[model samples]
Structures are given as structure tokens and as C-alpha cells.
Target: MDDKTAELRDIFLDATGGEGTVTERQAERRGSLVDVDDPETVDARLRDLVATMRERYDFATDLETDAYLRLIRGFYGDETDAALADAVGVDAETVAWARLDCHLVRDRDRDDDAPDAIRERAVAADREATRANDRFRDAFVDLLTDADLSGRLTSDSREDGLREATEDIETNVSL
Candidate 1:
């Protein structure tokens, strides 16, 4: 098309000695869109998070994101919080804080009653961590995870989850 392009194409033709079309390549799948249900895929995503967004979320525990993956794995695997704490070398309270920070609420009370609210709690809890208020640190997980097992978080409630989380956090969790 242009002089620079023609020169590069001639160089490519001489080097490769081919008629000219280069094969396109596909990328390895990653990110939220990918369903990480399998164990290997889960580990890859966790490692990627540590590399990319470890600082992005004000995580409560000092454990590496590599270790926190175990916490998340155990959590979704339905492991008890205490057991997860032990696995991740932290106390159970730290486990709860991490869960809330990661937006993995297990509250049964608000499942059906306030489905979208559950997603908002994830955002709010991280903000609360930024405040470093002992009160918020102590109460948020319990407040979010209260009540016996009931329904579950709504699958489609995350469209505007961030804005809702900010408003709800400011309104309800005043220092």
C-alpha cells in the first residue's frame, strides 16, 4: 500500500520465501468471561490476578494472591471458613474479611430479599477496608453473611453493581 509497507513485504518474501499470507494466531483464553470451573483454569486465572490486580482490590490479608487462590477455591468448594483460614495461614476472621473483599458473600438472609444488595456488599466491603475502621473491619462480613443458608446471589445483578455499592456503602456503613 505504501513505500514502507512494500519494503517490509519484500523483506518478508525474501526471508520466508513464500507467496505471502501469514497465519493468524489465537490467544489463550483468560479473564472474567471465561468460565473457570476446571481446576487448571482456576489456577491460571488466580495467578493472573496476582500479577495484574493484587493492588487494585485492597485485600485485607497479607497473604500472596497465589495463596488466596486456595481460599477462593476452598470457599466455592463449600469449605468452612475456619478451614479456609487454616489453609491460607490466617484466622477465620481474616478469611471472612477476604471473602467480603473479594465479593464472595455467603449471606443467606438477603439472597431472595435483596439480591442486588449482595453484589453491592462486595464493593462496599473493600471501601470499608480502605477506611481501616475497626468497626467496619469487625462487622461487615457478619452483617453480609448473616442468617442461615437460604437462596443464592442473583446471577444478573452485577450490571450496575459498582455505583450501587458506593451509594449503599456510604449510606449504611458510615464510620
Candidate 2:
């Protein structure tokens, strides 16, 4: 072995008390920081996250914090906005607004009737937010200001424009 290699081996042996054979260390699996599989734990964790989000932002949903979390769970769990509306006895438009407030946007959130400026900006901002793992609501606010439009994201009489495949995904148990 070269002088430098022999020196490193000696240092390694000294540091490891002469057991100098190196074993490959297994890589740790990376994932969510919190355990999310337990329903009760997930429920509590989501509530806390939502509560913190509410304190930081102005939410369009008037639902209580816990109710809002359940609404989000149902949405990510594949329940349509209409079905969630029925469960809450509100219009789907309301549910859509709530969904946007929570940053749970899908491509179908683009509205044909809305002014193209608002529609385009909302879609772009939502997409960028998803890609960056950031808040769509905050980005939408900036985009709306930049476009100089009062963003009426959607109106009454519109339907869910997303395909069924797009509507269903793994339940997002986080805010």
C-alpha cells in the first residue's frame, strides 16, 4: 500500500480499536418524518397541521378546523367534490373553494368561464406550487395580483372538469 493508504488504515484501525475491516453501511429509507398509518395518529396530526395553516393564512372554508381536515381527507381519498358537498349539505362550488383554500388543486380546477387571465394564472400557479411542494394559495394570490384580476376561480353551474382518473389519488393525510 502507498504511504497515504497505509496511514489511513492505521488511523482507522486506531479509531476502531484494531477491528479495521469496514462493513458497508445500509442506507436509511427516507420518507415522511411522522408515522402516518395509524388513523388516530393521522387524524390528530392533520388537525394540528390544519390548525397551524389556518393561523397563518386566510381560508375560504368556513368549516371548523377538524371538519376542514376531514373534508381534505375525503377529497384526497377519492370522494368527489359533489359527494363531499352532499355530505356537508353545501354546493359543490363551495367544496371547490374549500379545496383550493387547502391547496388541493387538480388540473380540472381550470375554469373555461373565468377570465383567461385568472384561469391561466391559477392553473400555472397551482402547477408550480405542486412541483415545488409549496402552497398554491399563496402563489395564486401573487399571480392574481400580478394579473390584476379579482380571481373568481369558478362560478355556479360549472361541473368537475377533471376526469375520474385524475380525481382519485392516495389520501393526503397531511395539510
Candidate 3:
């Protein structure tokens, strides 16, 4: 394989949890369909792999994932929900819900209230804020600005970093 093809293949492999090198489990399931000479085929497979990754990780639907990925990649700077949605080709509501699911954004509520009510309130507040200031629009941006976390999520170390972060949060759980 040429350098570029190898690199792209490695990227998709890692993105789909292959860790640069295919695992025995993957071989069992996918059976090594990659063709180094066929870059287009590889690209198609990579796209499919990314779709599967998005579904498995629950990163939001395809539109939301595209938007979130753009935000994380720094393509959109402090954009409001509508702007981001337009940029990503999804609705503002989809972006809003994805932000919450990704844990990289939150609304303006801190009271210790019932979970459902708090969520509803936060969503309503976020939607209104988006419509009003547009600055207050869906994503807060800074929530996932930590370099370590962002680096991990953007690179091959995503699973490990996520695991560590989750463990840290679990340890810090007060109750």
C-alpha cells in the first residue's frame, strides 16, 4: 500500500475501534476486505465504518455527528445553533439534543430538581436562548475544550481517554 492509502486505512480502522491494526475479532467479523490498490473502495469502506462508529458510540445521528465533528475540529467558531445547524445540514433542535447527548454542552439550570423536569427545563431554556441571543444557542463549546480530552477524542487514543475520563467521573460521583 502507498503511504496515503495506508494512512487512510489506518484512520478508518482506528475510528472503528481497530487500533491501527485489525484485531482477531474484526477479522472474524469483517474478514479483511481492504484492497490497498483500490483507494475508492477503501474510502467507501471507511465511510461505512465511520457510520457504524457514529451509531455504536451514540454520537448523535449522522447530521449531528457531522456538526459536532465540525465544531470539535474548530471549523465553526462560537456559532449559534441555527448557524451550526445550517453549517452541518441539520436542524437546530437536532444539534441541541446532540449537544446534550455528547455532554459537551448544557443549559442554564443548576437547581437540584427532578431529573426529567431539569432536562425539560434545560432544553426549553436552551431553545429559547438559541432563539434570543443565538449566542446562547445550543452548544456551549468550552465544555469539551480540555486539550487532553479533545486530543484523545480526535486521535487514535479516543477509547482509552474516554475510559479514563469515565472512571474519573465515576470515582467523583458523590452518591
Q: Per-residue lDDT for 31-53 in model 2, tens only? A: 43233345676667566666766
Local accuracy of candidate 3 as per-residue lDDT tens digits, 67-155: 45554333224567677677777776666655444333443333454366446645654554455454322223222233444565567
Candidate with the larger lDDT of 1 and 2: 2
Candidate 1 lDDT for residue 143: 30
Show where candidate 3 strays beyond 4 Å: 1-60, 73-76, 109-175
How many residue pairs clash (N, CA or C atoms closer than 3 angstroms) in each of the candidate models, in the order given? 0, 0, 0
* Least well predicted 10-residue stretch by lDDT in candidate 1: 142-151
Residue pairs that clash (backbone atoms under 3 angstroms), model 2:
none
**Per-model CA lDDT versus the true structure:** 0.59, 0.63, 0.50
Distance from true location, Cα of 81 in model 1, Å: 0.6
* Best-to-worst lDDT order: 2, 1, 3
Q: What's the TM-score of every candidate structure?
A: 0.41, 0.49, 0.30
RMSD of each: 17.0, 16.8, 19.2
Clashes of 2: 0
lDDT of 1 by residue, 17-123 (tens): 77576665667755332243345754775666444445555565677776667766676568988899888888876777667755455665135654464446655
Please report the TM-score between candidate 1 and the true structure: 0.41
